[model samples]
Target chain A: MADHKTKASAKTSSPSGGEEAYVPPALANLIGYYLRIAQEASFQAIRQGTGKSDLKPGWYTLLTILSENPGVTPTELSKLCGRDRSTLTSTLNGLDARGLIARRRKAGDQRSYGVKLTAAGEAMLRKLQVIARAHDERLDAIVGKDKPLLMTLLRRIVDELGNGYPPPPARGLGKTSRTR
Target chain B: MADHKTKASAKTSSPSGGEEAYVPPALANLIGYYLRIAQEASFQAIRQGTGKSDLKPGWYTLLTILSENPGVTPTELSKLCGRDRSTLTSTLNGLDARGLIARRRKAGDQRSYGVKLTAAGEAMLRKLQVIARAHDERLDAIVGKDKPLLMTLLRRIVDELGNGYPPPPARGLGKTSRTR
Candidate 1:
């Protein structure tokens, strides 16, 4: 429906004017529908702003979390990202290969290590953050003063829906010693 | 943050209680951050409810569109889904392989075909819709009377952000003859 970004007046009408707007019948009123579309637009805008196609969908989330909570173990990172540990390991490997993150063994726990973004990762994140902020600015421009409420609403949806879903796999991390 | 869904009180506290809540400082306030989380939850919920792990993201959107716009060309489907043509073809092919949708050449335009759901496709969609409606009800329970307002807000965000992004690739479809 948004394919014609330039033709503001033709929001519905095709170029030939042979058809009316195609409002997705079942999807028009669904919250998930809007969430999917809006998220796609937000992601595209950020990708365009960053000019970096190499970073996959969840990379920024990983980088941001690492930036805030440095040296979080793989299991902890998996829980935070809602991704399985095996997938998380490969993602960490990709970042590590790019020299963006490093894994270091904990002083007492010789078997387990923590993942943290390296100086290079920090630089990449700084660059990405500037672009992300600009994207947020565009979103802010749209929502204006309702931004906080929108954030709350969005968070509420996440919280309520996630209430009874399967917990992220802690695997061999054990019940008592699971990383926070 | 939502990894411990089974323990309602542990929204922040881990089992050990040895650590305080770990919040991604920068992402906590961002709209896209919440959107990503909420979308992930919504997708997971629908996937679990439908019991179909193979549908893949965007497949439902395509099926929904085909269910509504019975004769939309591949190009039109691509624009509606915000995906490029090549990727759209593969998705359509997947659905075709599953006997869910059929492509019929348009009358007088043998070169072009309209994509629509088959009887089996319609049956599958009916089953999925029930699950999706339940998911939407959960969203409704969360937002209540604000559902309409939330929808408007989400649409506004989609429209405003989509204003100047690159148009979905409509290669060879031509500007004036583009399908609606």
Candidate 2:
């Protein structure tokens, strides 16, 4: 079993000479097993990095996308974040009130609005980007040389999983999404 | 950019002569981005599979752990699932009410209880296990033969990230946890 092997290897190879290795269930062999836990770590790391900030849990994703595609529609942005429009509105409104993002009707398409990062929004994004970079660096330090390997696997899972499964109703990010 | 390349590749390589390929943002390069979306997919799959089940989100992990380790302690289960005692209590009580898990004082240690799966619990777990396997197969079909590769990569991330970052309150699973 994977748990048995990991425990045995840890017992023989550990420098601490103690019970450092944990015996995980057989389900640990599944990708779902690790996703649940690793996602928790990722969520916590983001919280630690963005603590007490005005941005909500999913805000950074919104800002990052808006920065990349300046005239993106709210509906398209909602699709990108895999969030429903209603859940996204309050966060978008918060950013708008803070003057971090601006919404305007497109010249030709009055039905849809273009969302963009303002000068202040861009400035805030720069700060958030720094925090994200540092957080990512910490993950890289742990994942080490396999960091790229892990990224490829995750990205592949996202693409492949997306191919098969319809996105769930984005109800506050399943378990991780929350307002600060 | 990752999205640009994806958009370009999709534009050029589309056999359907249409736009099925999605251009993910720069954040898609990060593990958190994929985790959030993948977790959404996993949640929907499970919800669809277990729509009327009384068991909540964290119940599967609890049942899975109990079935594996018949006399495991709550503290140990908490450690394995990365949940706190406070959060585990509510879930444990629900399982207890359902007569799925039994908590009894250890023969020697009068203070601590050793939790085990009841007969009904084991039966329910077997049924849930069926749902879990089919669900995993759906994911496997998506991830393809590379399922093992993705699983290994995820396991490494969990171990490596866990060493650096403490568990994130174990707030219902961040992604998905399933039976073996």
Q: What is the TM-score of each candidate against the true structure?
A: 0.77, 0.70
Best by TM-score, which number? 1
Q: Tell me the whole-model lDDT of each prediction, alpha carbons only.
A: 0.71, 0.63
For model 1 chain B, the run of ten residues with the poorest summed lDDT: B12-21
lDDT of 1 by residue, A1-180 (tens): 234554432333222112222358788999988887778667766766655466554577789999888999998887666554666777888899999999999999997899999999998888778777877887888888888778888877876776545443334333353346
Docking class of 1: acceptable
Residues B1-180 of candidate 2: C-alpha lDDT, one tens digit per residue? 112122222221112112232445667566666666566556555656676677455577778878888888776676565554466778888889989999999898887799999999998888777777777776777667777767766665555654424333333422322111
The best candidate in terms of DockQ = 1
Writing each residue's lDDT as its tens digit, candidate 1 over B158-177 gives 77666545443333343464
Which parts of model 1 have CA positions greater than 4 angstroms off? A1-22, A53-57, A165-180, B1-23, B53-58, B165-174, B177-179
lDDT of 1 at B149: 79
Model 1, residue A165: displacement in angstroms? 4.8
